[model samples]
Target: MDLNDLHGIGAGWWSRILAGFHRDAGLEPTLLELGLILAVALAVSVPRASWRYFGLFVTMVHELGHAFAALTTGRLVKGIHLRFDQSGAMMSRGSGRAGAAWTGFWGYPVPAVVGCILVLAAFSGWSSLALSVSALLLLATLLFIRNAQGAVIAVGLALASSLLVWFAPAALLGHLTLALGIGLLVGSVRDWLNLLGVHTRRRHQLANSDAHILARRTGVPSALWLAGFAAVITACWVHAGMAVAAVAGFPA
Candidate 1:
């Protein structure tokens, strides 16, 4: 056959092959993607050597929680700092007593609530919605990120999430959504447990903890504040489970 005839034959064959692959690819998550989701879930299930990364993620969420609370309650957010020592801080101004109390109150439980929402959205097949919301929150938090490291981390996360929302395939997006949702939920729970452990075992080191700050402002005991945080997180976990179960059966 001539070169033109050969070229047409090759192009037509390639197009048919691509169409076949697309037809079989489907939109649902595949077995390999599900395995990946399982792997991510297990990676963040508990506090261990790999927990440093989880801690950083939780710290970002925690600080962003405070920042959002500050802004929502009529406070002027100045900046946020995230450290490698599994700690973070948010600076704000113009917040009166009520605003301060709220900002302090939200720092602990907000991560759990956010995790719950993510889990619900992921399980309900709202992958795009989940990624979009996550990217927006990270972008909003980016405005208050003060330090170089914090800015890098926030910008990186926001960009990755934006790319996923805009370009990831449906199955890949769903898989990643579920993985991230599970990781956040597990990390938040582990953080809460760790907070309780620290507050109980190292009572003298409670000076900078959110519970201590809340206690100082509200004239309540730090232990009570810690207990309240635990209660709210527990409730959120339960409700998150229920929501996920309603959509995709109980999570194994």
Candidate 2:
């Protein structure tokens, strides 16, 4: 056997993972590639079967939003619980009402926020660093996972990111990052629309919604909270849309 194999991730792998940070991933996608990215994004987000799995990832991101936001206000994030049914909760302690509201408001719009960041990374040629950071965050999230399913999801994502960072071509990662970011952006919209549907058609599930929970907790109107989510998501979408338009050579 080779000595490099004995060392596992040899020097070459490290170089691949770090190379994009030094050099650009290159502004390289054609219009057809942009369409392909959009199509892949829609494919994962639209079909019920695909959403069944992808939704869980989105839910994880949603819960992470709450977890990190709680941490932002000096609250202890006790744990995060995620389920296969695309539902999740973050348990935190020692937050006053303002802090509570601060954490509560982060869950819905954060995936979009992340999407924009990923898009910017790809465009800015830091896609490798983006994947590396994402992998680290996924592993870090495992520490907070309270359920077996959550642990499994976090581990899987972390492993996939790690593998991609090591083996996937750095240039291709830009395209991959664009695809993932747009897919997440689409997933964010899908989740918000589902939440809106919950309020409109299924009051039974209103208790499960962040908007309603915020309203009940703060006496503010749920519609306003919903609007807040909408506003953030729309802004991300528009920003991402312009980037996508540029990538596709279209007028923004």
Candidate 3:
């Protein structure tokens, strides 16, 4: 094998990836453009065909949120299990019920938090940096993947992210990031709706839900936990909306 075939990424590509770290021109979306982006985001997130693949990325992010939160509390993370069906679990050893509650809380809200960060980065001329950093972080999660499917998803996502960063021009990266950020935000809402359906329609699946788990552990009703997740996700949407609103004048 040619030495240039290093992990499918040549040595020169390192500079291309590293070079994205610097800020370039920021693109502020017009009201009409913001509406269009939202529609495109919804197209991917709301459609089942697109969601079947894209939702896996959201699930990966969800599980990583649990692991990151556990680490934040000094918990020892064991491993992560992810499936093609978009289900996942993160194992960790930790003390303190509060810590568990806190960790549990993050799984639902983190995608929205990340979405807001991406949107803000797009508006601030850091879209390339955001994409590169995020892809590297996704690659880092490979260390914690315990199952075959999880390994595949992690590697697949990292490669996709890397390719996007490597090939997308700086001028267009902001629009792409904005669309991605919006997709994540929309996906978060869709997942939340599915969880809500689990509680309201499919009570049998409560065992697999974060809110129910929180309620069982904290003695806080599941409704309240769900509310907490909604609150955070809503706040992220509001913040991102305001950022768009600042630049977007009256819609034509």
Candidate 4:
């Protein structure tokens, strides 16, 4: 079967699954043009076994986002990572309530943004460059950062998010924004509590402890950063939408 045929079958299966979920939730899930995009991405990504390294790159992007956020807030980055079993790069910021909050709040959005970029690149026919850049980013992140779980989670999340965007651009993008925000909020709260010595159990430990380094001057407000992140995500959605439109020969 042609790639399109294969993708159509996959899309049909996914549609049924989504329809079931939507019915259960008393909501509607729009049919998206993600199948073709996914087919293209898969066709391009699967040929080379080395493409798996892109996973590492996704991890790096996640860590780099945390690192950048911490740095912007005047926090020191103790370490970072591009590779690990369960996490991504870890930043070690100094001790402070604001610093802790910022670190936690900045975690998930980075990977989400990276995933958006990857989707854009893939759809725009920059697959090779995307894969190469992703691999390099992952290698660098692993070399520099320390949070294994964050790196791993970030990569996994990015890939999953990209797939969602590819398959269901409209619904998935909004959902991703909300989900990412919730995750960041939860992470921040957990980190703040951990910093206060509220949770000492190893099982309850935050993932990016290494990413939080020495504390620095409190510069930008976490709220502002979050707002900016939201904007970036919106832009990403627009880009993805346009790409899909172009692929369909619709006016962008």
Instruction: Please list the C-alpha lDDT of all candidates, in the order they appear.
Output: 0.73, 0.85, 0.88, 0.46
The number of clashing residue pairs in each candidate reads: 0, 0, 0, 39
TM, every model:
0.78, 0.91, 0.94, 0.41
Best by TM-score: 3
**Which run of 10 residues does model 2 get worst, by summed lDDT?**
18-27
lDDT of 4 at 159: 54
In candidate 1, which residue pairs clash?
none
Between prediction 1 and prediction 2, the one with superior TM-score is 2
lDDT digits (tens) for residues 1-252 of candidate 4 = 999999997686445334322211111213343443344444333333433443343345455777777777788878864444324545566767776666655654555555555445444344334433443444444445345565564556455533543455433333333323223322332223333342245434423333222122345543454455555555655665565456556775
Best by lDDT: 3
The residue-by-residue lDDT of candidate 3 on 1-252, one tens digit each, is: 776578566665677778878998788777777788888878878899999988998898888899999999999999999999999999999899989998899998888988899899999999889988887888888999999998999899888987887888777788888988888898899999999999999999999999999999999999999999999999999998888777676442
Q: 196-247 in candidate 1: lDDT tens per residue?
A: 8778787777877888788888898888888888888888878866765554
Whole-model lDDT, candidate 2? 0.85
Instruction: Name the TM-score of candidate 4.
Output: 0.41
TM-score of 3: 0.94
Error of 4 at 165 (Å): 23
- Local lDDT at 90 for model 1: 93
